[model samples]
Target: MFATKYRVAGITALAIAASVSLAGCTINMPGSTSDSNGMMDGGMMGNNQNSSGFSGSDIMFAQMMIPHHQQAVDMSTLAETHTTNPELLALAKQIKDAQAPEIEQMTGWINNANASMDMGHDMGMGGMLSDSDMAALAAANGPAFDKLYLEGMIGHHEGALDMAQMVIDSNNAEAKTLGENIVKSQTAEIAQMKKMLAGM
Candidate 1:
């Protein structure tokens, strides 16, 4: 029985390895079709071996990023509730508008992947914020608040970039698309934030 199991595992690996040579590689794995149009093929699927849903790396990336994105949105929300500066308020609204949809998208991916919703269950990085961090942001005001907010947001964006790179490094094709997008978006945002911080 053990020998038979090993043989099955070896065969599975062989099949997967062989599929690497197929055209439109990233989104197209064997045992899958791209619908009526050939153009719709693997480009969208990202070379997945499993048809049921997301790869493990993809799931991990989604779970971790959801909370990380949420934190950025959450911090931004604080500015609306707690600040008076028009400039700072505008920044807060921008962060909230941008990240809120991203949080939803990540959440949808986690659900679609058949992954657990309880981020507490070792779901990577989407855990709740610490009480102290919340208080520090809450108490800040004026340029001091703007400086802290920008600094804090930069760290938050860095965390997202780290998790995104984790997905890219894993080479989960479908997830890599999302990961690459995150890298592009956050890197730009981080640079922008730094410029704002320097002026402050």
Candidate 2:
């Protein structure tokens, strides 16, 4: 009877330990809470990518940056038709080339998290240009266009760097990798643009 009781006790202990371990794992993963009515905020859905180890910050970074990079690509497209300066043209091409792939990559990250990409109109952070500013840029041509493109893009790149840095603590390996790449590449591009603007 003593031996049977010992075995039962051991089994109970193992079951309790397993439950505790699973609880710890659940606590460590990112999670969202719903309202008392059980309705979850749309942003919360975008912020939680626990399946991929992504935190809220990682999701925010990717979402904000998608529109921001799209703006850069749009501005770069303007430069193609509006500017005569070879340097400005080359820089515009480079911006589009680098950011297009990044935009796609960030989109994948957001989708992987099952997050909504439609983050609404006010998603602008860092140094995002106003719509009026973009309109003015579109209206410009020749040296004026070059000047505006260089200045505007420098600000845009700064914003990207800011977004990337904000997600530096993400546990998601892919998000972290993209963030690091943005910091390194955009920093160099920003410096190069500064030099070009000064020379012009």
Candidate 3:
């Protein structure tokens, strides 16, 4: 019994020593950074806050959504041309007027930026409409157009909100502030659209 107890104690001590050795080995591995550098290299610390991932989330959301808003405006304009209903035409006009100026506002910001950049919508985060979605909008009219428009725009706004949050999370002050503004404005607009959809 004493031999058995001594053997178990020895084994336990060996195991602990081995674990400690392994931990030190891991920390001292060649070119393996410790602290923040280790966190950075491991992609375990967090995404960069200053680089692409660190850059303002607002700019990212806006650039991607600029083209998206332009597409919506274009769809609204087309709907106005094909529809005879004053209610629908007026709604389409409102969409065009509101989005056209926003598109200009965003593009002007980009043009004024210190660098030129593009967010390939292929990245899956741009929140822009797919080609099929635009086609669906193109074929819709009257109440149908309004329904599609509301549904699609709601989704579009949600996408912008999603991208905007990324900027906020990344910790860019300007981006974060703009992202908050977008969230507030868009959430309100989405509620308004729900009411409009219900009326339709």
Model 1, 1-200: lDDT tens digits are 11111112222332332233222122334444557644323233323424435654455456556766777787888888676877668777877787788778767766554446443432223223456766887898777767777777776666566556545754445566777878897788778878887886
Per-residue lDDT of model 2, residues 1-200, tens digit only: 11111112222332332233222112122355556743243333223446655655566666667887898899999998998888888888988998899899888866665666754433325556777888999999998887777787777776666566655655677877887888898899889988998897
Residue pairs with clashing backbones, model 1: 26-46, 26-47, 27-46, 27-47, 28-47
Q: Which 10 successive residues of model 1 have the least lDDT summed?
A: 1-10
Q: What TM-score would each prediction reach against the true structure? A: 0.65, 0.74, 0.57
lDDT of 3 by residue, 64-132 (tens): 557767776876777775566676576667767776877776565445432234643323233345677
Please report, as a residue range, the 10-residue window in candidate 2 with the lowest summed lDDT: 1-10
**How far does residue 157 in candidate 2 sit from its true spot (Å)?**
1.3
Q: What is the lDDT of candidate 3?
A: 0.53
Q: Which stretches of candidate 1 lie over 4 Å from their true place?
A: 1-49, 84-87, 119-129, 169-174
Best by TM-score: 2
Query: What is candidate 1's TM-score against the reference?
Result: 0.65
- Report the Cα lDDT for residue 66, model 3: 73
Candidate with the larger lDDT of 1 and 2:
2
Error of 3 at 29 (Å): 37
